[model samples]
Target: MPRWFNTAGPCRPDIHYMLPALRRLPDVQRLIAQEGYFVVHAPRQVGKTTALLSLAQELTAGGRYAAVLVSMEVGAAFPQDVGTAELAMLDDWRNAAEAQLPPELRPPPFPEAPEGNRIGSALAAWAKAEPRPLVVFLDEIDALRDETLVSVLRQLRSGYLNRPRSFPVSLALIGLRDVRDYKVVSGEEDRLGTASPFNIKVRSLTLRDFTAQEVAELYAQHTADTGQRFEPEALALAFELTQGQPWLVNALAKVAVEELVPDISKPVRRADIEHAKKLLIDRRETHLDSLAERLREPRVRRIMEPMLAGLALGDVPEDDLRFVQDLGLVRMAQGGGLGVANPIYREVIPRVLSSTAVASLPPQTSTPWRRADGRLDMARLMEAFLAFWRQHGQPLLGTAHYHEIAPHLVLMAFLHRVANGGGTLEREYAVGTGRMDLCLRYGPDTLAMELKVWRDGEKDPLEEGLAQLDGYLAGLGLDSGWLVIFDRRGGQPPISERTHASDAVTPAGRRVSVVRA
Candidate 1:
C-alpha cells in the first residue's frame, strides 16, 4: 500500500513520512542514564507519544533495561476521585507493560496498597520484581488535575530515592506543559506552588517543530515513494506558511495532494498549496477548531486580546505568555517581539474570532464592486462600505466579543463578504502597534487600508493615520488608499454629526481618503 500523510494520533513510520523522532530529543538517553526524572513537553501532536514509544522500544530491546511507555490520560476522567483515578492509571500501566514487555520484564500485578498510594507501591513492587533496571515514560502526565494530579506527582517524588531497586531507575513525564505549569487546586480553591509538587523533575525539555530541512526531507519521502514531486516553490511556500509546524506541514501536503490536486503525474505547485491553506481554514478542521476553542480561556485572552488590538501587552504574567507559546499559538517575531506563529495562524486567528460577526453581515446589495475590465473599483467598494457602516456598524459592534477590535472586525467582515468571490484580504497587526493594516487583492488591483481607533480621552488620529497609510501604500506600490478611524469615545456627536469621509495628502505626497465613523 502507498504511504500517505498522517494527521491523527502518533505517526507510524510504516505509513507516514516522518523525521527521526529522537532528532529533537537529544538529551533523553543521557537523562535516562543519569537516573533522572524529567518532563518532556511540546504542543499537541508534535510527536511526543511517537518519540517516547519509539525510545521505549529501543531501550527495551537493548538487553540492559526494561522500558515501557504508559499513558495517564485515563486518570483525567476521574479527577475528583483520587482512588478511582489512581486505580485506572495503574491498570493502564499494567496493560501497556504486558503489551510492550517480555514476560520477564512486565510489571507484576499492582500491590494491594491503599488507594492514593497504589501507584507508588505498584512501581516499587515492579522495580523489585524485575531483573534489570526499568525506565518509564508516563505519557499525558499533565492530563490529570486537582487531587489526582497532585497524588501521582507526589507518589513519583516519594519513589525518587529508590531508583533501580525499589522503583524505576528513570522516568519521563510527557505532555503539552511543563511540571511548573501544573496546578493543584484543593477545597476553597487553595493552590500549591510549583516548588513542592513536581519539584523532583531534574529538567524540563521541549520537543521543537521540524526544521526547514527536515520538512523538505519528509516531503521528499513521499516523492520517492509515489513518484510525485512537490515543486521547489511549493515546498518553500509550505515552510513559509507552517513555520515547520509538523501537523500543519503534513496537513497541507495531504490536502494538496489528496484533495486539491490528485494527479500523481503532476507536481504540486505553490498555488495549489495556497488553495489548500484556504480550504483548511474554511473547513475548520479539528486541529484549527481545537485551537479556536482555546480563545475563550482567560489566560489565552490576556495574551491574544492585546495582539488583536495591536496594543502592547500590559503586565501579563510571564507564565501566561509562556503557556500561550507552549500551545503553539504565538512565537517571537523577527524584530524581537511576540507575533502569531505563522501566516496560516495569522489568517485563521482574526477570521475565527470574527466568525460570528461575519455570519451576521448584511447581505451584499452592491453591484459587483468591479470595473468593466474586471479590476476592483476602489471608489465603488468604499461607497458601499460607508453605507454599510452607517447602517449596521453600531449594532454589530455592540454584539462583538472583542470590543477593542469590534470596528475593525466589522469592516473586515463587510469587506470579506463583498470580496468573497473576486478578491482576498490580508491583515497585519502586532502588539505595541496602534494600527491594523489590510491589503486587499483583486485580480490585477491591490488596495491598502489602515484602521485606527480613538478611544476615550484620545484625540482624533487623522494625521497619524494618514502618515501610516502613506507608508503602507508605498510598500504596496500604490499612491492612494483608505485611512479609517473609528470614534469610540463616549459623549461624542451623534452618528449623523460625526460620520463622514474626506481626502488628505500625506507628507510623502500620497493621497489618502480619510473616513471617520
Candidate 2:
C-alpha cells in the first residue's frame, strides 16, 4: 500500500511521510535526563503528540527507563468537578500505559485516593511500585480549566520532590501554550489573580514550524514514491503560502495530488496549488474555520483589528499579544512589526471576517466594470464603488466586527464580488504601515491599489498616500493604480456629500486614481 499526506491526526511513520520526530525535538531527551519537569507548547497540529509519543517509545525500548505519553483532555469535560476529572484522567493514563509500555514497565493499578489528590497519589504509587524510574508526558494540559486545571497542576507540583523513587523522575506538560498563558477562571469573569500553581517547570519550550528545507524533503518523499514531481515553482509557492504550518503544508499537497491532479503520471504546478488554495478557503475546512472562530475573542480583536486596518497597535497588553502569537494567528514580520502568520492566513482572515458583509451584497446586478474583452475596467469599478459607498457603506460599517477597518472590509467585500468568478484579489496590510495594498488580477490585467484612512484630528492624507502608493506601484512594476482614502473624521458631511473620485499624478509621474470616501 502507498502512503499519503496525513492531516487529521498525529503522523504515523509507517503510513505518512514525516520528518524524523526526535530530530525535530532534540531537547526533550536532555530535559528528561536532567530529572526536570517542563512545558512543551506549540500551535495545534504542529506534531506535539507525534514527537512525544515517539520519544516515549524510544525511551522505554532503551531498557533503562519506563515512559508513556498520557493526555489530560478528558478532565476538561468536568471543569468544576475535580474528583470526576481525576478519576477519568487516571483511567486514561492506565489505558495509555498499558497500550504503549511492555508488561515489565507498565504501571500497576492506581492506588485509591481522594478527588483532588488522586493524580499525585497515583503517580507516587506507580513510581514506588515500579523497578525502573518513570517518565511521563502529560498532553493537552491546557484543556482543563477552572478548579480542574488548578487541581491537576497543584498535584504535579506537590509530587515534584520525590523523584526517582516515590514520583516520576521527569514529567512534561504538553499543550498549545506555555504555563504562564493558562487561564484558570474559577467562577469569576476574569482569571484568578492568585499565582500559578504549576511553578515547578524548569523551562517552557515551543516547537518551531518546519523550515523550507524540511518542506522540500517531505515533498520529495511523494516524488520518490509515485514518480510524480512538484514543479519547483509550486514547491516554493507552497512554502510561501503556508509558512511551514504543518497542517496546511500537508493539506496543500494532499489537495493538489488527491484532488487537482489525481493521475500520478502528471506533475503538480503552481496553478494547481493556487486552485487548491481557493478551494480550501472556499470550503472553510475545520482548521481554517477554527481560526475564524478565534476572531471573535476580545484579545484576538485587540491585535487583529489594527493589523487588518493597517493601523498602529497601541497600548495592547503584552499578555494578549503573546496569547494570539501562541495560537499561531500572528507572527513577527520581517522588520520587527507583528502581522498575520502567512499569506494563506492573510487571505483567510479578511475573507472570513468580511463573509457576513459579502453575503449582504445585492444579488447578481449587471455592471459595466468588466469590459467586453473580460478585463476589469478600473474607472468603471471605482465609479461604481463610490456609488456603493454612498448608498450602502454606512449600514455595512455599522454591522462590522472591527469598526476601524469597516470601510476596508466593505471595499474588499465589493471587490471580492467583482473578482469572485474570473479573477483573484490579493491584500497586503501590516502593523506600523498605515496603508493596505491590494492587487486585483483579471484575465490579462493587474490592478494595484493602496487604502488609507483620514481621521478628524489628522491632516489630509492625500499627499502622503500618493507618495506611498508610488513606492508600492514601483515594487510591483506597475505605472498607475488607485489610492483610496476613507474619511472617518467626526461630524463630517453626509456620505453622499463626502464621497467623490478624482485623479492625480504622483511625484514619479505615475497617474493615480484617488477616491475620497
Candidate 3:
C-alpha cells in the first residue's frame, strides 16, 4: 500500500512516488492534437517511456483516441533483418495493446502482410478498424540500425499520406536520439546528411530533466506518504548533485530512505544525501555504469578528451557534439558551451578513465600516502605521486585511451589510489581554461591541486599556474595548494630526472608547491 520512488521503468501511480509524467512534457499533447508524426528523445532513464505511456493512457481516457505505447526494442534484436524485426515488433505491439487497452478500445487482429510492409500494413489495419482515431507511440525506435532502421522510417513515411482514416492519426518515435543522430550512429550520416527518411516529422522534442522545484515536489510525495520529511538542505543538495535527473532524483531518495537512513522517524539530512551520492557512484548502478561505459566511444572521446584536459574543443563536427549531448554524457549551457551533464557524471568520467591506470598502480603506492591518524597526508601523497610518476607515468600514458589528456588521467589515477578507500577526489575543468583543478578529501585533511601543461612555443606557465592555484585555493578556503606543470616541450628531460617540487607564492601570498616535471 506504500508508494515508493520508481527507477526501473514507467511509473505506476498505484505504487510509485512520482509527479504527473505528462507534466514534464506538456507539449506532447499539443503535437498529437495537430495530428503530427514526430520524435521524442532524451537520455536514457530520464522518464521518456513513463511520459509517453502516461500520455497514451490520458488520451485514451479522454475518449478521443485508442492510444497505445509499444517498444521497438524487442525488434532491435534483429537489427539487420527487417522482416524478422517487423514480425517481432508487431507481436510486441499486439501484446501491449491487449494489456493496456480496454476491450472496446483494443484493435481487432493485425492483418497478414509481407516482410517489408508489415509494420505499415498492421498500423493501417488498426487505424481503420478502431472506432476512434488511433495514436501510437513507438518507443526505442532508434534501437534499430542499418537497413532495418531505414525500412522502419520509410514505412512510417510511406503511410504519411493516409492519416486518421487509414494510418494512426499521430505517431511518435521515441528513443535516446533524434532522427539525424540515429543516422550518425548507423554510419549513414553522409547519406542522410540532407534529409532523414523520417522527414515527415513535424519536430523533434526532448524531455527536460526536472526542475529543482519539481524535485522538491517528488520528494515531498514520500513525506506525505510516510511521516519522514526531507530536510531543506538535503532537498537542495540532491537537486544540486543530480540537477533533477529523474532517475537520479528517485534513486538518491530511494537509497537514503530505504537503505542509508531507513527509519521513518529520522528525517533525510544533507549528509545522508551526500553519502547516498557517494554510494551511487561507487556502486556504479546500471544507469550510471551504462553512461560510464560510453566514455571510450569514438564520438564521446572527441569531445570529452579536450574537456577533461581543459583545452579548447577544436573544430568538432556539429552532429558529433549533438551526438554526445543526446547521449546525456554532457550538456550545453544556455550561452553555448559544453560540460559534463551533472556532477555525478563529472565524477564518473575521470574515475572510469583512470580505472586502467589504477589497476597498473603498485599496491605499495597507496600505503605510503596514508598516515596513522587515518588522514591522507598531503605531503606524503605528493611525494608518493612524484615517485610513481617517475616509475610508471610513461607506461600509464599508453594505458589511457584519450591521448591528449593522458597526463591528467595518470595524475587522477594516482590520486584515486591515494584516496582508494577513505577519501574522495573531486575535479573541475572547462574548455579553454587551460587547467584542471582537483580537491582530495580524506578524514579531516583536504588537498587542493591545479594542473597545467607547458607546450612548445609557450611560456613557463609557472606564474600563471600559481595565480590559478590561488583562485582554486581561495574557493576551497585554503591558504595553499599544489601546482603541477608538466613540461611537455620538445626537449624536456626524463620524468624522473626533471620531476621536482619547489615552493612559490601566489599574488595573494598563498604558499604553493610548484611541481615541474
Candidate 4:
C-alpha cells in the first residue's frame, strides 16, 4: 500500500503516488520547448514540488533534455551572508545532481569560485558542455537572500538568449509567492527589479486544491488496492470539512484507514470521517498549526476580519485579494462574493485567533450568569459582552473589527463559554453579506440569532433588524428569533429601560424580538 500523507516535501513515487495534472502538462511542455522561464506557486503542500518534479522526469525521460531539481530552501536559514549562502546552495545543488543523475552522465567536478556569479557561471558551463538540452527546477526559490536571489535570477536572464546550445533551455522557479513580487537587494543598497531578472517568464501557474470529485478519486485508489470501500457519505463529509485540501484529505483518510476502521473488510463511514476531523483538530497537527500562524498576520487579518463579521468589503486591490486567495484564506462565493474557504478553516480561525481571549473568559457557573432551560441565554451573553466592552473594547478596538457590521467573534466567545460542552454553535458569514447569522443547536431545540451593530446614529433599527431576523429564522425553520443589536451610541439606556418590541409575525406565526445590547 502507498503512503499518501506527505507533509515533508514532494511526494515520492515509491511511497505516495498521485494523479498527474495532465491538463497542465501540455502547457508546461510548451513553455519548456519555447525556452521560457516560468513560475509555479501555491499554498504550501498543495503539490507544487511534486508536479514540477514529475514534469522534470517526463521531460528527461523523452531523451530530449537533461532535467535537474535543486532546492534553495536551506540557503534561507542563513541570512545577510551572501558568500556562505551561495556556497551552501551550490553544495546542495551538486549533491542533488549527483544523486539524481546516472554515473555516465554526471558532469565534471563543479567549479570553485571565491565570489562573483559562482553558481550562475557553473550552471552555464555545465549546460554548455552537455549534449542534451538542459532544464532546471529551482525549488523554494524564495528562500534565497536578496543578493543571492538577484545574482541567480540575473544569471538566468543573461543566459536566456543562449538556450539549448549555450545554457539551460527551460527553467522553473517554484515557491509560495509569484516571481513578480520577489525583491532582491544588493550589498550597495541597489534594488534589483523582479521583472528585470525574470523578464523571460511567459506564464505563472498555481496548483489548486482538489475538487470534490478529485478527492474521491484519490481515496478510491486505496480502496482499489486493499478492497476497503469508503461509504459514499464518508467522502462527502470529508469534502465538507476539508474542502479537498490535499494534506487534510490525505490525513483524514490515513486516520480513517489506520485508526477508525477496525478491519480492512469494513467500509469507512461518515462517522469515521467525523472522528478523523476531531482527532486532527484536537491534536493540533502541524499543518493546522502552520495555517493558524497565518491568521495573525495583518494582511491575513484584513481579509479575514470582514468574512468573520459577514461583511466583506470591496475596496481592496486585486493583487492583495489574489494573494489572500492564493493562500487559501478565502474563496469566491457562487454569487460572486468571497467566503472562508472551508469548514475546517472557519472553525480553526476563531479558535486560533481568539485563544487568548477565550482562555481568559470566566467559567460558565463562576459568573453571575446562567442560561435558563440550558440554552444560550442571549440576555446574559449580551450582558457579559457589554460589560467586557465597557472595560476592554476601547483598548481592543484598534485590533477589534469595529468597522465590521457584526462583531460575531466577541459574541461567539461569550456563547462558546456558556455552551462549552453541552451544545454546538454554527456560524454562517460571507464577504459582502453585511450580517452574521448564528444558530445554537442545543438539546431538542435550537436558538437562531442575528448579530448586528448600529453605526452612524441610526435611531430606529427595528425595521432593518426585523428584515434580517426574518431571513435568518426562515432559513433555520424556526418560529421565534432574536435580533441582538449593539447600541454603539453613547448613553444608551439598559435593556430593561429600552422598549422590548415585537415586529410583524414571521411566516410560522412566530414574532421576532428586537433587543438592545
TM-score of each: 0.94, 0.96, 0.97, 0.85
Superposition error at 301 for model 3 (Å): 1.6
Tens-place lDDT digits, model 3, residues 1-517: 9999887988899999888888778788889999999989999999999889988998999998899999989977886788999999888988999998999878778888888899999999999999999999999887887778888888999998999799999999999888877752354333354567898999889989999999999999999989899999999999999988888999999999999989999999999999999999889899998898877777778899999888899999888888888888889899988888889889988888888888887776237677787767677777877888898877888988888778888999888776766888999988889989999898888899999999899998998888899999998999988999988788777888988898999999998898886
Off by over 4 Å in 2: 186-194
Each model's lDDT = 0.86, 0.88, 0.87, 0.71
Worst 10 residues of 3 by lDDT: 184-193
Which segments of candidate 4 are over 4 A away from where they belong?
1-4, 21-26, 114-116, 183-196, 312-314, 363-406, 442-445, 457-461, 489-508, 511-515
lDDT, residue 58, candidate 3: 88
Q: What's every prediction's RMSD, in angstroms?
A: 2.3, 1.9, 1.6, 4.1
Q: Write the per-residue lDDT of candidate 1 for residues 1-517, one digit (tens) a residue.
A: 6788888988778887888999999999999999999999888878999999989999989998999999999999988899999888888888899899988888877779987898999999999999999899999987778889888888998999888799999999998878777656633123354565678888889988888888899999989998899999999999999999888999999999999879889999999999999888888888889888877777888998889888999999888888899989999866789999888888888888788888887666656577788887788888877877887887788656777888888888887885686778889999988999988888888888999989888778888888888888888899898898989888987664677888899889988788998
The lDDT leader among the candidates is 2
Q: Ranking by TM-score, best first?
A: 3, 2, 1, 4
Off by over 4 Å in 3: 184-191
In model 4, which residue pairs have backbone atoms overlapping below 3 Å?
Answer: 312-432
What shift in Å separates residue 480 of candidate 2 from its native position after superposition?
A: 2.2
Which stretch of 10 consecutive residues in model 1 shows the poorest summed lDDT? Answer: 185-194
Give the C-alpha miss distance for residue 284 in model 4, angstroms.
Answer: 3.4
Candidate 1 lDDT for residue 315:
97
